[model samples]
Target: MDFNQLKQELFDYCEEINVQKVGIASTDTFDTLKQRLVTQQAFNYQSGFEKGTVEERTTPTKLLPKAQSIISIALAYPSKMKDAPKSKKGDRRGIFARASWGKDYHDVLREKLNLIGEFLEEKVEGAQFKAMVDTGELHDRAVAERAGIGFVGKNCNLITDEYGSWVYLGELITNIPFEPDEPIEEGCGDCNICVDKCPTGALVQGGQLNASRCIAYQTLTKDFLPDEYRTKIGNRIYGCDTCQVVCPKNKGVDFHLHPEMEPDPELAKPKLEPLLTISNREFKEQFGYMSGSWRGKKPIQRNAIIALAHYKEVESVDTLIHLMKKDPRPVIRGTAAWAIGKIGREDAKQVLEKAKLHEQDEDVLVEIDKGLDFLKVHTTT
Candidate 1:
């Protein structure tokens, strides 16, 4: 079969599989992306979730010896929930970002890529294709941009004309010499809303991100969150969407293209109180399918404690006190003690004082002291 005919066939199959967009790119080295990676490394700006070395990420042939083209695919997800439940006062809820709203996109994208590989295998005899999603060495946004699927927006997300930046990206490298699509020259122009509205100012002038300062990256960390971002994260338990939410390109773009991408109102915005006490088995059963649960329950529970404190919910103080006194993990214990202080219920000082005497961990002791310090002059409610 000719290259154009194969591409047309592949596009048809992509439509059948519900892939929102598909584009072809050449196997040229990503020179601009390499320079940016070098700068990011020099400045200590990487989120540490990045995989592989710089060369492995930028050079396509390194991953596939006879690589002639790359196939990029995008799947659109919902930006708003249908009957989204609100996070009320006593029955407060913590939110998972839209990316983690449904079944893990990594699994969804990988499954689709594998199916594409099967389609190509049937069409091109003895064709070799290697597929990957977000966890892959090759930057999905860079590949998608080169493939003409989208332009990398100032938020550093691949923004498609149809789906905005609300699409999950994946790609496969193939030996088939398919015609490459022209990269979009359309730009963000003077629109700086995403950069200006980053909650923690993680977005630099031209889309470079200091991942260390990003709340989205901070949410996945297992340690006690930094003091600066505690209030900034608000009720976000998994990731932050401030950048995307503020972008003009993303306005009025809420696509429910895939059933698996739909958010379950309960799991996506679970009651903060129940999450604080969710057992390992229960947590896995309830949230294992969601991408946000990859770091396990520790960070989510800690964030839940912080969200409760954010509301100054006196009712949650009892749960926080239990976590402070009994939770084995120092991160959980320390964070809970801090939350108890922030809540400042009627018995706050007394409870913190009791825990201070018995806490063995120096870190936990420090947090307990911090809690007591909150009650220095002002009386508790």
Candidate 2:
């Protein structure tokens, strides 16, 4: 079959498999991508992506030339569990968004895309193809946008008329050319709710996300919460979803069609008190398959302590006291002190003072003193 006939067959097959948006592009696509990455200031691309940095390493492989066409796909994943907990003080349980609560999407999407790649090779004459989930060097989101899959939102996420911004993207670069699809128009006209609500001001301007200041990046990337951002972090212990949650366009979207996107029961709304006490083995066992679990248990545990501090519940004071003296990580100890201070417990000052005398680390000692000061102010009232 000729290129047009092959393109029609490819489109029909993808539609049969529920894949959204497919396109073709040359190997020179990378040149345009490199320039776009430079304009976006994603990172200094001169060295060809950092060893393990997400910005550098997020997309792992590039397809070699002789692949004349690039086919991209997007799968919607919009399962709503519940709203953020309302208590300003208490356990303040938080659930993972449906998209992130299950096994990583990369593994799932790559497996499916590889199957499609195998099919293409078997059917086409002397055909060759490479598939990628979000794990490829190609700009899958940008390509999907250009292919009329969706428009890019002010949150810097792809938003589809059918799925809003709740779809996962994957692609297949093949040695057959096909007609390229037209891009959708931008849907986020005059709406800046996402920018206004960002606690860290991560959205600098029209749909731009500053990774350095993003809370999602802060919670997942940094070994410990920076002191300057701790107070503003609120209760997000893993990744932040505030921007997606508040988007006006996301309303009334039905998630019932995507049963696979449903969140795990344990993660739907985990109790922080129990979460704070988990052993390393338990942490791994519970979250081993999850995206948040890849960073290991320490960062999440530290953020949990910080969340408890922000809640300032009297019930959390005992938990804070226990963590301060016994937790293995200094970051956790520091957050525990901060939590104790937040709770305004009578014993907070005494416990911090005792910890201060024994605390050799200057940073932990400073946090202890801050806890002590908070307690002093509360008791004098």
Candidate No. with top lDDT: 1
Please list all clashing residue pairs in model 2, or write none if there are none. Answer: none
Candidate 2 per-residue C-alpha lDDT over 145-194 given as tens digits, one digit per residue, 9 for 90 to 100? 76678877888778888777777888777767667676787689999999
List candidate 1 segments past 4 Å from native: 377-381
Model 1, total clashes:
0
TM-score of model 1 (CA atoms): 0.98
Q: Mind giving the per-residue lDDT tens digits that candidate 1 earns over 246-296?
A: 888899999998999899999999999999999999999999999999999
Our tally of clashes for model 2 stands at: 0
The global Cα lDDT (0 to 1) of model 1 is 0.92
Model 2 quality (TM-score): 0.87
Q: Work out the TM-score per prediction.
A: 0.98, 0.87
For residue 227, give model 1's deviation from the true position in Å: 0.7
